[model samples]
Each structure stands twice: as structure tokens, then as C-alpha cells.
Target: MVKRQAQHIQVDLQRQQLRLLSGDACIASYAISSARNGAGESRGSECTPRGLHSIRLKIGDGLPENSVFIGRRPTGEIYTPALAAADPGRDWILTRILWLSGLEPGRNRGGSVDSLRRFIYIHGTPDSEPMGQAASHGCIRMRNRELIELFERVRVGTVVEIRERC
Candidate 1:
């Protein structure tokens, strides 16, 4: 069993990178894509809510790559160029998903800006989405291979900090 610990996951939107940290030491860092509309704390705004949060639930462990999902349930079919072409407009959320919940109650937890209620996740995406660029509805999207590796390193209740570039 993976013991849950309070680790830090820092996202630098300006740098388009996600850094995993244990205390003051850096564990791993990878390129990431945040909300294209920029970051904020608002519901139905399709913007990435910024501030302190934690991994509420981690989903799709041991699942096959490219496995289609809607509402977090497997659709039992792997993603392909053909399937992608069929639905070019579809935003592919694949592989693993780290569902996030905001720590701040009034800021990002309850009400419209609730991160959990918004289904915000750090999930795998098709390679088509460029790394180091803002291009997601609200969640942070990472490449499948990178996400799988990341998923193995973290656990539920991991701390995630998102702040505007200073």
C-alpha cells in the first residue's frame, strides 16, 4: 500500500512546468499545460483555479493506455487516430487522473469554484496537445507516459500549490 504523505506539487504556469517536491528538495519536474483562458478561482469559467489544493482521488490506476473515459468510467476502447478523427472536437482525458480538491473553503472549495465539484484533475492527454503551452479547459493535462510515471510517485492528500508567476 502506498502511504499517503503531504508532499508538495508546484505548478509554474508561466514556465509551463510541474515540479514535485519533498520539503525543500526537488523530486521530479515535467512540462504541463494549464487552462488556456488563464488561472482564476471561478466556477463555469473554464479557468484553472489557483492556490493550495490536494489530490482528492486518484483514478485509472492499472488501466490500459488510451482508454476512453467519460465521467471517470472506462469506455473499454483504446484511443486511436481514427477515433480521434471521428471526434476532433473531443478533449481526450486518458490514462491516469489525479482529481484535485481545493483546501480553501470560500476561495476554491465549496460553492461554484469548488475544484472537486468541477472535476478538476491532473490527467493524461493525447500527444497532440503541445507541452509548455496553455491549452486545456480547466484541468492540467500531461502526456500519458509522463503522467503514469508521476502517478506512481504521489498519493492521495498530496499538496499542490498553484501560483501566478512572480
Candidate 2:
């Protein structure tokens, strides 16, 4: 039996897209949101830390769409317009989540901009969240349906590269 290496994940801030690359070929691409203020290489800055990372945890597997999650745990309630309206201040995390950990030591790991310590993730969001736009508070956000598919395709230890557009 052949052992297959995990796919690589790439997030291009300029393109506002996340790509799943298998070897040298692109397998999937989806809209993504980075930091609102732009990228950085520090922890606790609420800025999207740059450099290489890995999937530290994959949360909310097998969950239905609109499934509510807080701190990465299912809340057991489906999202609705009414719920959103009632808690407009909520930073909604829905569908699926892929928690990321920084690989660089001084640049984006174990410091203020540490992606793992920063709780950065590529997660599902409400459709209302704008795509191809920089609107998140440092994490990457995708549509619920799209993220569900991505969550299923990727695995822990998948490499993630966040880079500026050239």
C-alpha cells in the first residue's frame, strides 16, 4: 500500500482565496477572509499571522449546516436569522473549523502573533459575511457549505501557507 501525503493548504490574501494543492496541482479553491487590518507576524495582535502553518485541530466534523459552535464546541442549535438578530454582537463560528498552528518560531509562533495562541482558524461563517473581502478579525472565514466540504478534504498536519500577493 502506498502512503499518501496530506494536501497542502494555501491562502492568498491578495486573491482572497484558499487553495488545496495536491503535489503540484490545485485540487480545490474557495473564498477566504483574512485580518481586517491586514497580515502580521505577531501573536495576540488580532492580525492574520503570515508564514507556514499546520492544521492543529479539525473541529465540528459531521455537523449539519448552520450548526452553532462556540469555542469550537457545538452548541446544538441551528443558526437562524432570528438568532442572529437577537445576538447581533456574537462572533459567529459555524459549520466546520480547522484550527491552525504557526510553524515559524520568531516570526509567527510562540509569540504575540502566534497563530495557534491567537486561536486562528479557517472556519465556516454565515452567508451574510462578505467573501473576497478582508472582513474577519484575523481568522479565515468561508461560507458554511463550502467550509464543510473543505473540512472533509483536509486533515491534521496539512500544511498552510499564508502569503501576500505578488
Candidate 3:
């Protein structure tokens, strides 16, 4: 299958949705989970930072769906219901990962608001986790299959904008 180049991604924090766009066309839309703490621009706040960002890196290109990731590196364990049940409180990062870095200075890039330092990413979560709601530690979370489809359609340096509303 020929893949389409993604132009940009808009993340609506208020609605808990992520949209992939190409010019005026809406390529795909997926339910996403943002931060439980709402939106802010400070490290350690556990909040999703607002403003423009880009996919600095794309990890798990060929990794299996539900492949576990920690610190952007695969841990060799695939996510399963039993594993999730064992660690109910664990912040699960699964499948593909789209690591994001802020572009706007002070507001989201530098000092205490540096998104890269905050380890912000758009990644996958367990199938049991609910989407279209704020439930993540900081990163945006999507379903494994949906995330894989998105990951294949985008590349590093793709623009991402996170906002409180549409």
C-alpha cells in the first residue's frame, strides 16, 4: 500500500481527540487520552503542555502491537491483560510511539516547560483503557492498532499542535 504523507496533526485536548490532516482534507481522526491533570506547561506537573510540537522521533516501527516500551526503548514484553491486571496502577506505554518536542519558546520549549524534558509523547495504551478522556500521566494515549496506523502514515518532524479546544 502506498502511504500518504501527513501534513500536520491537531490535538484537541478539550475533546480528547487527535486529527491527522493534509491541507484542507481530514485524513483520519482518532480518540485520544490526554493528561489527567489537564493542560499546563511545567515539568513534573503531569499536565499536557499546550502549543506547537513535532514528532522528534518515531519508535517501534516494526515492533509488534502491544509491544511494551519504557523510556522509548522496547522492554521485550508484549502487553497483555494479565500483565495489566498485575500492575493496575502502572502507566502503560505500548505499541508505537511518536515522541514530541515543543517548538514555542518559554511557553512549551524552554526552562521548566520543556516538553522534551517532560518526556511527552503520543503513544499507545492497553485495550482496556478508555479513550476520549483525560487519563494519562502526560503523554497522549491511543489504541494500539490505531496508533500503528498513524505511525505508518507519519514521519519524524511532522507538526503537532496541542490545544485545549478545537
Candidate 4:
């Protein structure tokens, strides 16, 4: 049997959108929140790296919506407004997580610019948080339901290209 080509994701930093594409056609598009610090590839920069990347892992499968995750592990707490209120300063990683690794050697991968070392991800965010904006610390933030849907559709090794299209 021939292996199917993996679908690719295109993240437009300027538009704050993530599009899933198969071949040349767009399969899905979602409003997303990227880095408020903007795009870069340096460790400790807290900025989203711009380049070709791939899903290194997919987490939170079969988990309920609003499921809370900390350090890539489920925290056994579902996200609630009260919970959010209690930890207002916390950067919530909810529902699902799509961990990414940069494909480029120096631009976003390896050494000081390693995206995998940076722990970059496309993850779920609080419902109160707005999308289609640059608000995250460095990772891509999606709506909880939207992220679950996306997580179901994508697999590890899917290509993700993050770019700033002016």
C-alpha cells in the first residue's frame, strides 16, 4: 500500500490564521492567537518561530473539551471560568496540544533556535480569550472546541509552515 501524503498546515502570523491544506486545496481554516512578542527563533525569546515545522506529537486524544494540560500532561482539571479566575496569570493549555518541531536546521531548528527545545505548540486556550490576534507567549492558541476538532484531524508528522505574509 502506498502511504498518503500528510496534510500541511500554514500559519499566517500577520493574519493570525491556521489553514490545513491537502495538496493545493485548503481543507480547514481556524482563527488563532500567535506570539504577542512576534516571530523569532531564539531560545528565551518567547516569540513564535517562522519556518517549516512538523507535528512531533499529538496529545490529549479522547480527552474531554476544556481538559487542562500542564507540561504536556493532563492536570485532571477541566477548565472553568472560576478556575480561570483563580489563576488569572496562568497561561492555560487546554483541550488538546499539537507539539511542533522545526524542519529548518538553523532558522528554527537545532542549537539556540530549536523549536522543539522551545516547546512550541498549537494548543487550546480559554474561551474568554479572543482569537485572530497575537496574544500568546509563543505557542499558537486555538479555541477549545476548535482545537479538539483540529487535533482529531491531524496526525504526528504533519507539516506546519509558519510565515508572516505581509
TM-score of each model, in listed order: 0.94, 0.92, 0.95, 0.95
**Candidate 4 ranges with C-alpha deviation above 4 Å:** 1-6
lDDT of 1 at 41: 77
Global lDDT scores for all candidate models: 0.87, 0.85, 0.92, 0.91
lDDT of 3 at 130: 99
Give the winner by TM-score: 1 or 4: 4
lDDT of 2: 0.85
Top lDDT prediction, candidate number = 3
Model 3 residue 15 CA deviation (Å) reads 1.1
Per-candidate alpha-carbon RMSD to the true structure: 3.3, 3.3, 4.1, 2.9
Question: Model 3, range 1-166, lDDT digits (tens) per residue?
Answer: 2123448899999999999999758899999999999999899999999998989999999998999998899999999889888988999999988999998988889899999989999999999999999999999999999999999999898989899997
How well does candidate 3 match the true structure, expressed as C-alpha RMSD? Answer: 4.1
In model 1, what is the error at residue 70, expressed in angstroms?
0.7
Model 2 misplacement above 4 A: 1-6
